[model samples]
Target chain A: MSQPQPTVLILEDNPGDFFLVKEFLKRTSLPAYEIHHTERVADAIKLLQEQEFHLILMDLFLPDSEGIQTFMKIYPLAKQAPVIVLTGLVDEEVTLGTLQQGAQDYLIKGEYDEKLLEKTIRYSVERKHNQELIMRSEEVSRKKLEALVQERTRELEEAIKKEKLLVDLKNQFVAIASHEFRTPLSTIRFAAEYLHDYLEKIDEAEIRSKLKKIEKQVTHMTALLEDVIMAGRTDLKKILVVKSKIELRNLVDKIIEDVQNSTRNTHQIELNYNVNSKEIDTDEKLFRNIFINLLTNAIKYSPGKESVLLNIKEETGLLIITVTDQGIGISEEDQVKLFEAFQRGTNAASIAGTGLGLSIVKKAVELLKGSIRLQSGLNEGTTVEVRLPVATTENKPA
Target chain B: MTTRILLIEDTEDLGENIRDVLRMEGFNVVWARNGKIGLDTYHEITPDLIVTDIIMPLMNGLEVVREVRAFEKQTGVSPIPIIILSAKATPEDHAEGLAAGANIYLKKPCSIDNLMNAVRSLIAN
Candidate 1:
């Protein structure tokens, strides 16, 4: 009713032996088969390469290969097919050797009747199929294990790299912080030494001047520590943006006054604004931090230069602000890394700054739904521009 | 003769303080606030001894030492004992300072008395 399940191969050189096998098969009650008869081992190898066979009836004595080794040549090629050796009476021991080398069973040339031959072929096919299934499953498991090992190795490599980076970052932080700590400590120590060396001979003016130096150094150190803490808060993801209504012109004016009071830098900060009363819903703390950072940068950079220009425009519910300094600007290479945390400009190494100012400004601006850009070049000057959408009660920052 | 010392540091207050202590300890000290100015002072004064800070604008301390070495090689001047008084505190930093041709390396926040002792020993030799 359907196609035969087993396609049997016969590799016998003798015609009488081949005829006896055909006669035995013809008398069997088994299903009809597509049998291929090859008298040469070479021809059997070619047939096995060309197509898959279910069962092989092989003779150890072939046209080109003889004895137990004759089965070895065809066995590798016809591994998909189960083999049964057909042997004469004198070669019974050699036929058993063939069975040991992956052949299923053997049939005596003149002695096997129809029922015994059918039983041998049926059981050989079953055993060979089970062996192939076991091999396929083992091959699959080996490949799966290799892939899993590769994936785990990659993950561990990534984790190790991250750990190394974190350690390097910690060392870098300690180095920078130690420098900051020393400057102020040196200042206080100097003041103490001056007083200790000349306590009786020094007048009130000298005492007042040294005390003022100590106070100023302490203030500077406090500001630096606060910046470090702010950077830590950003690293910890602890900054919360809460919206409050603020007047834009007053805020700028107030920040400018505070910078003037705190800094001894004599650079005149000019605010170019006509609007005095434009109110918007924004986070006041974030806004204050951003504006003050920009103003400090402007005043600090424009050291020999006279004026810092802060141009502000409030139009169409958008605030565009630009702060320009005619100070020593950043290089083209350093500008790309300027907004990254703990990165400083090449020209600012001698300047008393912790390199956290711009990064904090960047994060605060992002939280305020704003964008910041810098136009700077070496010895040319720097201009930092910022844009923020004036959100209403309905429109807000995330 | 008063031993003249050239001091290089970036921070204005710290430089003044260190100079004050050295001047009080009977050394004629000339101070410069940055590396470029300090290098110029070295060329101009050719002081008996030199003290410097490492992290400075323009030239930095190691660059100053290297340039001074080159200058001494060109002119064949007597080698000056150089001391690195810096904020960087690490054994590796100290080793680098020595390798850069400095005779002494002292980390910052050092007491005035300790600094005076170092200056006295170096200047006396």
Candidate 2:
């Protein structure tokens, strides 16, 4: 029976040494043979790519490439094949060097007889197969690790984006808070200084106005702080709409009175309430939020303008309130993001505003199952209309 | 004659306070609540010196400095002294304010006396 022959590629420059190696291999247990021989390392590379060899018998020195360079050149191209380096030099140092750099074993020529050669060839073939197995497994594990790293990177990027967005929102909040607080605090400081520095000479009317300014500023500061807190709570879904029986007429009147008293300007706000229901089941805090936002917006926008018309009426079971301002109205573009948090109209940009008023108003309206609309043109005027379904006995703002 | 100064601040009460204090100090001060309005008031009053906050809507302090510099260049007038009053106390902000043609950059919550001194020094120069 013919033994299963392992095909070998021998890279050697010397013809005598090549023939001797070939004869030695023929006497081995690998009897039937297909031995490919190349004198040049480059030629051996081309042959290795074209054909699959079980093992390689290579001379470290060649005409085209020499020593470590020769082996390095063909080593990668000779994929999955175990190399047995045959050296005529017979020096232990050089042979060991090639073996260390991935040649499976080295044979010193004329010294290795048939049995030793046979044993070495068998060992080289077996060792190469095992080495290939280890390499293949390592390759698979490396691929898995790479894919895992890529996936983790993607997840981390998404997390970072979300974190950056939260940071940006927080930064915007801080900046707004600083600007918002500065107003009332400065008002109190200035008013107090006025009272302190000029108390004796100042008349009762002047002292009263200064005190009123301080009072108004305190109210404004409290409201601002409350709004900021409410907004934060609302974002966290912590603030729930609390519904109770509220005197709608009195609430409207009270807001009107406060707004009028607080406004430092001489501008008037004409409130016309034609609601039939005096009492309604609604959230008072939410109601106040919507009313104050609209009312303040009206007053603030119309700085030097005459009167703002605030009209509340019941039509088709829906209570509708519209606050009309003759101030510098918003442009078409600016109105698009007007209800977005921290967004202000282009014309209102220079004006002292937290840009939270409209946003809060929109949120409050949504909670009450109501809708708010804005109508404005550049240089014309602004009108904010809010329509809420009158909450009766069982109905509640959720 | 009182030194006319344009006080540009976004905060209304702050602007009012500064105006009152400046008035008490016997300076003719015209207050504007933003860079754009401040520039407009500058055109109106042609004040001897300008005191402006850094961050404001419409036009910021940097924009104001750039625009005012362009105006000065066009008119062939002695450059108006600009003092930046900002909450940004960082060295970078200070350098940027000066590079934008401001003569002085003062951090906010400044003592009224220090602000007056800065105003006086810049106006004198």
Candidate 3:
């Protein structure tokens, strides 16, 4: 059998009035109203806080809280509940004011019967459910809107990445094209200028020498075109690794030698071999490329610098190499993007490069099962450290 | 007998200069405007060594290398030593050319010395 019950909280400070309301609720043929009565406003507030009741019967006068102030405290909370005011003889005028402040209904204690009590309970419960329905719909709509906002944010991020890629490709193309053009122009310019002077003085031998210079320039342009095409293929993810064992110290020596010949502003390149006892198993050609790229970057960005250091060491079976350049330091903003493809630091704009060097270094290092990190600040110079697995003597047994 | 050489390039002036330079180096040169025609000419005379540009319409240098590799696999014949002439000179691009079965990948606007050295190495190897 279903329990015939509508639980109602009765809040009246005066004991006589509280008993009177309870007795009237009992006599009322309001089905089975389980009347839970509280004598003080504090008890009523406590009962409401603990659980949800079907309805609240509030009186205008309470020992602790009075009249409208009593209902105001309970009114907001009573919205969570259906509050029907139970007024006394002198407060008939006050009961009308309670209804104006969102109370479900008002009734004089002496005059009310079971019919009035049952009707008020039914109407108050229905009104509370309607307000809850509106609130629930609002909450659902807010969650859906938040989810849509998150999805749009992801799409915008992807679009920004695509735009960045396009810009980098265009920059790479322009740098490569200009370099190619300049090589031939330089060669022709030199050859023509020389020929103008040596055309009569040195005869055919000198002219042939000038021709050779021109030939060299033409070759330079062709190589530039090849680099641009190769870079495009790399962007397309068409490159693969050809692994081989490499001697790290020997490779560094070769790179240092190459850099010395290439750059005019000489910086003392100190190669400190802290990992002299170690060799690494990696693609030899790729190792050469890594060192070449690092050395090139160090040289390019450090124009007119006094000194740079290349420190190599072994720690925990790892071959660590540190290249520190005393030239122009990377700005704080550019440092974050230093290893990213086609990103050049603000201090490096005047330096000549396709901005592909460090990216290549990173990729090559990764293929070697190694890692690289950069440290730099504006005017404070820059240091790039690379760590790889060290090939011990046991690995290279004869 | 003039040694006939095939030059495949998208850029005309660069192609002309390369043809002239190689001619002065005592080789008869035939210029194919792009990689598609360059591959067609490969069957005609089977030129001594092919220098092909990487980016071109219809077919690119990498495709040409793949085709040559396929032909070599079927015929059991020694494949032509193809050198990739490209402006994309990243190390990854070099690796890509090698993976595609080219003998060498040379960046565009190479020094004359580098070009000669590469040609000499391929011939000697």
Interface DockQ per candidate: 0.39, 0.17, 0.02
Which candidate leads the pack in lDDT? Answer: 1
First chain TM-score, candidate 3: 0.52
Return the lDDT, model 1, position A77: 81
How much is A182 displaced in model 2, in angstroms? 3.4
Which runs in model 1 stand beyond 4 Å of their true positions? A1-7, A14-17, A23-33, A49-54, A61-68, A85-101, A104-141, A195-219, A222-248, A273-286, A313-319, A366-370, A387-398, B1-110, B114-125
Those runs of model 2 whose alpha carbons end farther than 4 Å from true positions after fitting are A1-165, A185-219, A235-247, A270-273, A302-307, A326-338, A346-348, A375-382, A393-398, B1-12, B23-47, B52-77, B84-101
lDDT for A111 (candidate 3): 83
Better of 1 and 2 by DockQ: 1
Report the first chain's TM-score for all candidates. 0.75, 0.59, 0.52
Clashing pairs in 1: none
Task: Give per-residue CA lDDT, model 3, range A269-376, as digits (tens).
Answer: 778877655456666776777777787677667665767888888888888888888767888888787776556776564344556677778877766678999998
Comparing to the true complex, what docking class would candidate 2 get? incorrect
What's the best-to-worst order under lDDT?
1, 2, 3
- Candidate 2 per-residue lDDT over residues B55-93, each given as its tens digit: 765677789988999999999988989988776655887
In TM-score terms, candidate 1 sits at 0.69
What is the DockQ score, from 0 to 1, of model 2? 0.17
By summed lDDT, which 10 consecutive residues of candidate 2 chain B come out lowest? B106-115
Weakest ten-residue segment in model 3 chain A by summed lDDT: A389-398
- lDDT, model 1: 0.83
